[model samples]
Target: MNRVKYIFFGILTFSVINLYPQINRVMGMGGLTYAITDIDYSLTPYNFGGNPAWIVVDEEETLLDITPNFQNSWGNYRRMYDSEGAINYGTAFKGVKRLSSKGTFVGFTSYNYEVVRNLYRTLRKDAYTGEAYYMIDTTQGDFRYTGPVVGLTYSWEMFNDLFIGVSGTYQITDGLKQVYTNAQSIFREVSINAGLAYRLSNDFVIASNIKYSDFQETIEAKDVNLLDVEVYNYKGDTYFIGKRGSSVTQKLNKKRFEYRGQVYVKPTEKLSFAIIGNIIPEIAKVLVPQNSLIDVEEVYTDFYTIDIQAKSQYQLFENTLLGLKVGYNNKNGWSNNSKKNLLMWDWNISDFYYGLGTSYKFDFIPMLIGAEFEISSIKADSSKYIDSRFTNVSASNNRIRVGAEYELFEDHFIRAGFNYGNDEVDVLYGGSDVKKLGVSAGFGFRLSSAIYVNANVQYRKVSTEYGGSLSRGGLSSFITLRLNTF
Candidate 1:
């Protein structure tokens, strides 16, 4: 009887219905559709200043979603100032609504709490720096961060063939160290994005987007112990100025602007293509408090970057899909010390990526399978004026992903995926010969006509050639409710 049942199930085809899944369905498929030219059931439209003018044309149903997630990781083969392990927990809320007949409104908010264990050196949120003009200490301790982020977006049809949209976001976080020298940090960021899309015809659309952002972070470290704390203020990778004090404070400020253009073409019902181009410029400044009335400028950096990508998707056969993607990025930056009238460092980096993916829906089974292969190359060059040192490095990385989804019964779906990757060298951590593996599983079920629940779990492991390993895990679940009024 069991053999008969298995044979019967194998003869029938299955389909997955989103009906309002918690996360994007593509994520369950190892993000195979990320570079696909289709926006339906995909989040590609939200990239690069969002080009949100397409929201009204892409989705019509109103939805409200709430998600709670937890993630944890432990690692010893990490960056110089990185944490040994960390825990992160967060919850998010999102809503979409149609305004009258011509406009769409989207709003989202999230809160997160993070615990970083055994962190060392720097007190910056992003430690991927030029190894210049930063303060560091030898003490290792734990840190806690709590933050809230909020955003709003609105899009509308301005004319028969023209659409416009705007969005704004604000984020603030507070971080504190648990051990001496005790440090406290406050970070804030605000950004705005605006875009316009014009439908030249039913088969072609063009869009342009612009974004601006401002960021600030302030850090203060103080020790209550009778002995003064000693720290190093770096001037370059190999040179530093040493200081001993009971208290130290620093501030960082940054501003960035971006411009993007996109063209989307659908020549036929089965073929679609998209191309995007972007330019960004940024400036950052670091300052150290010298006295009650004086603040010294430590370093200033200016950056320029350019990015371009193209993607295409074709429905080769009835149930077979193919996607191709290619992208390139280049960035150049220089850091200077105005007070000392010297150029500290100059850096340049370039990256190239190519990917191919395919998906097939089985005719005689209730399953859809997808696989993707990608390769990337990165090259970096740096020059330090103080030491007259020049260095150049290059690395290559390759990755493979496979995923499958099956329908167990009506309104019930299950998915599983696996990923593997190898990096000749880790650019950020300077690790040689890195290998990573990841596995994920997820399920979705409908509770009623308007409510649905979805959950997923993921695990990953990393190993380096020098006998160092790391393990990470995450779990996420969300409830989505929909309402229709017409």
Candidate 2:
């Protein structure tokens, strides 16, 4: 005999989830290199001083950078299953050209590209009872996204002792995912930035910037299916079989807006400080199966993220510099469906991080050295959720890095460095933790006064307390050449 059971399963569970450090020199130092100019302009859209001022008559410079990275990771989920020996590799390119002519106003354009850099996951569950009975249940999925970004910036002297700059960037990403169902998505991002720098005097300068960004993503899924079956023994030699079926289609959307501001001050030739703030508000909408399990309804989720950071640097001597950075990031989620007793829900996450760094240049040896140490305290809050009403979980991360650069000849360089870090994220996973260690070396050669080539190699390993480990070691090379109108 055969029996059929209809499982009113709502197919509404939608889940969604690297700058390599160093050119030739910083990779050897442990991947902790910091620059006020890169941090300010790259993150906040504020240019400290124009790369080339409005008055300078030197030819504009064009820069090219290429970076490729590889990683191998192994981990255990719920301590019940483990994925071992997974490898990931990706490559990124950036090119920037100054469009303004020599002895004229300054403007530039840039482009960035990345290839085949995405993630995939799978899950399967099965249950069966009785002799000669078997059941199979499985689901596999892939989330792939790639981006091409274009940016433009213009800077000119507004007046004597004052400067102004404006920049804009537009990015588009193609997102594709296939579970038991197939989905296609598109994401768009736009940013605009404006900044002003005023030199009150030679001893002091003030700079500030304001930036706005908009992000939107839409996803459509078709033909999602789920299956559950049971086989049991009847009386003597008779057997019975039972089966359930579920299928669905869904549409999901996410929209987010962000605003950022930064302020920088250099009160003296050797002292400088900067502060940055960011605020982001996000909304998510998705189609979910109704309680009866036959109809679909729309659900909304809201969340906000805020980040604040402060950094300061001091030149202790003519050849030595020291700096410190501190930051706090917070995320809060609110749910209005308080009455629904669901097994899974959303929670909030927060992280606080601080670090100290120092660099030194030897006047006599023609070499440079740098080092940094950092710590982060991470916490996950889910007390408001029904499943985690009683317990709170927390973790911490600690890291250290050191590197050095030596001039092998005039305009030629060689460098090497090593780093170690511990991510204590298993506080609730039987108190087991993960550790990371890596070492790297590289060399650079100047083909001409304006052309340079750099290459580097790194050996890295990640090991868990459950006897699972991952290793990634490979050779990566990139060339940087500049065009000048000298």
TM agreement with the true structure for every prediction: 0.88, 0.67
**Which residue pairs clash within candidate 1?**
14-366
Q: List model 1 lDDT by residue over 1-486, tens digit each.
A: 121111111011112222233344555655566433234533233442257777777657787777776778786655556678778777777788888676999888888898988888877765554425656777888889999989888999899988888899999999998677677899999999998899999888889889999998888778867567776777665677777788778888889999988888889988877888899999888888788787777888888989998877788898888888789988877888868878977878788999998888889988888888999998877676765666676889999998888998887888888889997755555555778787877777787787776666767776775433443333433333433332
How far residue 91's Cα lies from its native spot in candidate 1, in Å, is 0.3
What lDDT is reached at residue 429 by model 1? 54
After TM-score superposition, the amount by which residue 77's alpha carbon in candidate 2 deviates from its true location, in angstroms, is 7.8
Whole-model alpha-carbon lDDT for candidate 1: 0.73
What TM-score does candidate 2 get on C-alpha atoms?
Answer: 0.67
Off by over 4 Å in 2: 1-25, 34-138, 141-147, 159-164, 175-182, 194-210, 221-252, 287-297, 335-346, 384-390, 426-432, 466-486
RMSD of each: 9.7, 10.5
